[model samples]
Target: MNSSKPERRKTREVRIGSTAIGAENPVAVQSMTKTLTTDIEATIAQISRLENCGCNIVRVAVPTKKDTEAFAKIAAQVNVPLVADIHFSAQRAIEAIEAGASKIRINPGNMRSWQELDEVIACAKVNKISMRLGINEASIRNLKEDTPSRERTGLMFEEMSEYVREFEKRGFCEIVLSAKSVDVNRTIEINRKFSEGFDYPIHIGLTHSGLPEDGIVPSAAAVGSLLSEGIGDTVRISLAGKPENEIITAQDILASFGLYEKKTPRIVVCPTCGRCMIDVLSLAREIKQAVQEIQKPLKIAVMGCIVNGPGEAADADLAVCAGSGKGYIYRGGKKLAVVPEAELLAEFSKQINLLVAE
Candidate 1:
């Protein structure tokens, strides 16, 4: 596999609180709070959990005046940059920023009046906060107004261009941009155009990605491909589940592209076939469970045959190859033990602990 890192697109740097995106910065991971904004304690607790799990930034929906008030309290209690998800109401957008949002996401197409957008932009400028010109295809009001499904990306790009012009006219360059769609192809297409058309950092995600089981594959496909192309500055997986799960998914996607800063161990196991002579699946599962508390970014492999086992073992820090009733354990490509099948896992665990200790 050609795992060469993608050449990142050049973009102006934008900071949301202390976290920076674009202009060669590592791609940041973001997730939203699923709790109601008015429930200040619950929102705070959820944000804390997200921060603990390595989310770079957290967004909260602030659609009501009371939510903005609660948002202020939530912001006061947390250290992660908070983004206010605003829609339709420029007043809410302004209030959220005033209440201490590091950034606000709004769509100009959703706002009827230029004057209201001006107000939101002006408030953002005064607060010295960043703004994201988020364009969602499903939320575009004129979806059926002579626009074919095939042409939606064009419409989205045009809408984004118009908003960019308006922001630039107001001398507001502290901006991040995003265009999302539930359809994987559209999501990929619109973001590609965003990258080509603007130097602003792009937030990439598949919007309304269904429940975890349904969302993981499409989200991985859309988000992973964009990052691999160097088109995104930040990522949010947007699964309809725990927000922390979204953060984990985002981190995994970034790690696959070698764009994530934090490190965690990686485990590789061969897909056993007719040539296999041991229960590779059960042993691999045991190793995975055993390594939950290990933090070193060690590469571990479990192979069931000679076809690719030795080659894979050469690349791993610790590996085991099984044949019939026994297994061969290797450390740094050198044989360490030949143990019976029943003792393979125990020996593997000891080696893992020793490697981690080192």
Candidate 2:
């Protein structure tokens, strides 16, 4: 475990279906399906893709009874655990629980009243499903329109604590908590407060994180800060791109920190400068797309100049350093073979397969 504050609150282990969150379990990566839940086939297909991309949990919107009905079939067909994102409807939550959702994410303030909240809690308990109390900045209760900036996050924290206390009061401890805000700094602050106040595993992410280049960096920074402090147990990298993109982003972030093992080759490519080399960018793209289906951990480097390439990438398990129209294949910092530029990718692939097979 990463070094954390000595007084870190101990969170109860909550099982979302067969997967356990909190209590020393491996941090999970989750993504929501953009496909409408009623379109079971599309939802299942999207989820299947996410599963292949290493998404541990998948969430689908269950806005109505019909969507709840679809959850049964989708849950049955999908390989990963499923979560139902429910809003404003305890009845739908009940239906989704009956239909086989592993977890339900609800905004406590939106539920009709105390009775409705009780009904939702009861259904979750009876079904033995976990609940995620998802509280966002905009959804926080009892906040004045002109509240001071310094107290805004405190108000959000208070609301989250109230819901968590309510869930505990109902004798239901199977809970995951998320407090997301559009502002990355505020998101970090709220989670930091929660970490001090409670032991429940936190699901941290910046809501509405923009596009790939711009969005991924900040989102990773925010989540990374919390994770480095041993604060987050699961995370979602919300991006405007495809859901698979989010999964890949999450995997990369974890891998960069040495928190996740690469299930596929870890390609280390140098950005081509004025070194004058074969099409390094195009070659890297081709290799990445070509070997996307492989699932073993290996490191491959594509460098522009041989002088610094092999020496700089000496730590790579296998590397191809390009020079002029030729490339040298090196393993463990020793040159093994020289191949024409055109055949470099194929030779690299062959070597990777052999290494992975062994």
Clashes of each: 0, 0
The positional error of residue 279 in candidate 1, measured at the CA in angstroms, is 0.8
lDDT of 1 by residue, 276-301 (tens): 98889999999989988876777889
- How high a TM-score does candidate 2 get? 0.89
CA deviation > 4 Å runs, candidate 2: 1-10, 144-148, 212-214, 273-279, 323-326, 339-350
Candidate of highest TM-score = 1
Candidate 2: count of backbone clashes, pairs at least 3 residues apart or interchain: 0
- Residue-level lDDT of model 2, residues 16-120, one tens digit each, is 887898876777899999988999999999999999888999989999888998999898887799999988999999998898999999888889898998988
State residue 188's C-alpha deviation in candidate 2, in Å: 1.1
Please give the TM-score that candidate 1 achieves against the real structure: 0.96
Q: How far in Å is the alpha carbon of 237 misplaced in model 1?
A: 0.6
